[model samples]
Target chain A: MGLDQPLEGALAPPMRNGELAFEEPWQGRVFGMAKALCDAGCFEWAEFQAQLVETIREWERTPEGEYASAPAEQETYYNHFLAALERLLEAKQLVAGGAVEARSEAFAARPHGHDH
Target chain B: MSELKPQAIRAEALESLLIEQNHLTAEAVDEVIIRYNERVGPMNGARVVAKAWADPDYKACLLEDGTKAIEEFEFEGGEIDKLVVVENTATVHNVVVCTLCSCYPWGLLGLPPRWYKDPAYRSRIVREPRAVLAEFGVVLDDDVEVKVWDSSAEVRYMVLPMRPDAAAAMDERAVLELITRDAMIGVAR
Candidate 1:
């Protein structure tokens, strides 16, 4: 049978007139982070790719907890991208271990409606 | 505004962390984003498609070695090292997806469409191509064999769509305008 309904795991990316478009400021920011880091020679593009592939595989292997519940909002593709980027940075010693986690906590603790 | 999602928070955290450590500057990151959004994009792919339609020898070269032929454009970006150009024929149709992640020919087509990166598209396109293509508004005959190319880090793929008969009298410039990014991706014909 044709699977005509919306699939559970993946959400279509944000687009405009069939073109790649970012819906959120962070989506673009993370995308640029990965590309900029590669351009800066922190690691080869292939290295980042390896991390990304592994990250995605890990997600696929996951038993569909958070991803299954809120596929569109949680555990999105960019989440995998961020995970891969974080892993790469830590591996390359570009960022101190746990610094991202620490900083993320700080950002999360920011006042409600904080713009920056 | 709504409270930032954890993913967004993490993205910001990573950016600030990298900047604070001097590993990357916010300006550098912004510049890369701007370049992808403004400078590099599908026009390069359209030029390649148009040239293949206009020149037989160039078409042969493109079909033979996509990587080298695309290099003639001297485009800037990643994901063009080992490109394999697939031609759509009367009976064979080609569509691209990356089941693992979003592995696209960024140098040629720029950033992949969000739907291209969507997990549903990646998984469903391979298994039920005709149904998925129908959703994209591309309806193929029952006899047409649908072939899905799953892009990888090692090799990238771009479909060489057949020039529509309507463009038979059009010049290469006009034909180039007819080529859309989705056509090159084989989502639209």
Candidate 2:
């Protein structure tokens, strides 16, 4: 949402700092999904403080972006973030508190997640 | 402070010393980073497509809301304010081109791959989806209507190619093997 931040390279320093501190490297809308899901109550990522770090490390290993750093803990957390969410979804059976249900209706509430 | 500037000068001198010893090239260094981003950029989104195809509910959510659809994955650093995932279904097909400027979905997608960033590809794709795709070796049925999305302003799109029947039993990772970045932009079949 904010265009004020500088683009990567010859500009800003590395965005992730081994989990000590970091910036949101995503385009504005990528965040909207989590926000929308959060608003709907699919699950809040309050515990996601460390989750992002893991995800970053995962990105480093695959045929993805090869950062100068060995592998960031921040990325590793991020790499694991989805698994964490899925775990929560399975254990909680909750989507945005009950918002997951509404999101299920995102196009049309699946009355029960079944074909209409 | 003047003292601070002196300290900064010393730091630069020290950095230069390290650079000389390590055989580092600053200008070339940036080029390499950009090159890497180009190679792996759209592959991330390619994986997303595989996931959606394997799961029905995820596909519905993606069509309903692409931005949210991405959060369902582990990919990070997405620079998205808005996202529109276009599905290339049978009756209708979608091709993504950044006509005004290369506005890409960098989150689920790592970065804009090289060809998409090409001037020739950009200028021509919007004016001619069918023709351009043909160049990239992707031929579509003339009966299938092609919709070219000139991604500019407040919107960005990535194509969720209709899963090829050949990959029905494949897992998500296996399916990703079949999707090339060009397919995401509607250049390849």
Candidate 3:
């Protein structure tokens, strides 16, 4: 029932005082969602872990470094987490295809300042 | 094709979908955010620092075993591997960074500020601690030694910032209010 077992050793993210370190609020949100989903048995923990590993690997292979040099370029560890989560949810049929994209478009259409 | 968006947008989208599908509830998402924002954060670290400043015995325990000492406050997280507390003194100052990545003591300090995770900080802090501290407006004395702790997955560090003279008269809660996150990170004194 503990939240720490699946993310031990090589798979563990940088931590301080036993909590996961996140630079942005969304990073923690995404992280919490993934953990919550796993706890609810929507998918296996290993499944998400595999996807995350693939995402990180793909990022490492990109022409640029794993992170974008500029803020506008949009590369980050949590971005990959979102991408991987999307893939997992879609593949699991937990979410209908295009649901995430459609929701994202709706959010973008709003007038609020969107700084991620 | 869906455009790759920022993490916040994507997370929002994901949450909506999950809720719509009954995989998650809207309340769950709000609960997580509230937990991080309110229940856990720098205030926890500030309280710890305040207690250390007030009680020499607790400070001794904190310096000896940070992980165990922190548990006394009932702040426990599963992801933290090790907690090392570096004391800042008149002769030596300590700052922490994660060169390889943005490793931080989130259980005590909450989420890291944006600048702490910047590549410039990751690269520059190690090379020129004094100069970087200067940019943050922390000008150290010429005789003081600057020590930088690079946090890794195996171990994480928090700086025990030197107590200010004025703080001696303040109560624990007041002292806690004065301890900012930057000071605990050693970016500010």
Q: Candidate 1 at B31: error in angstroms?
A: 1.2
Which candidate model has the greater TM-score, 2 or 3? 3
Residue lDDT tens for model 1, B1-189: 556677877787888778777788777877877777767778788899888987889999999999999888898875567999999989999999888788899888888777787777878898899999999999999999999999999899999999788777997778888988898899996
Q: lDDT: which is higher, 1 or 3?
A: 1
lDDT tens digits, residues B78-155, model 2?
446578888888788888887533456655555454455444676677777788878777788889998888775467
DockQ of 3: 0.23
Q: Candidate 1's error at A17, in angstroms?
A: 3.4
lDDT of candidate 3 over B116-181, digit per residue (tens): 766678778999999999999999999999999998766889989999999999877788878988
Identify the superior model by lDDT, candidate 1 or candidate 2.
1
In order, the Cα lDDT scores of the candidates are 0.80, 0.53, 0.74
TM-score of chain B of each: 0.93, 0.75, 0.88
Positional deviation of B160 in candidate 1, in angstroms?
Answer: 0.6
Error of 3 at A43 (Å): 9.4
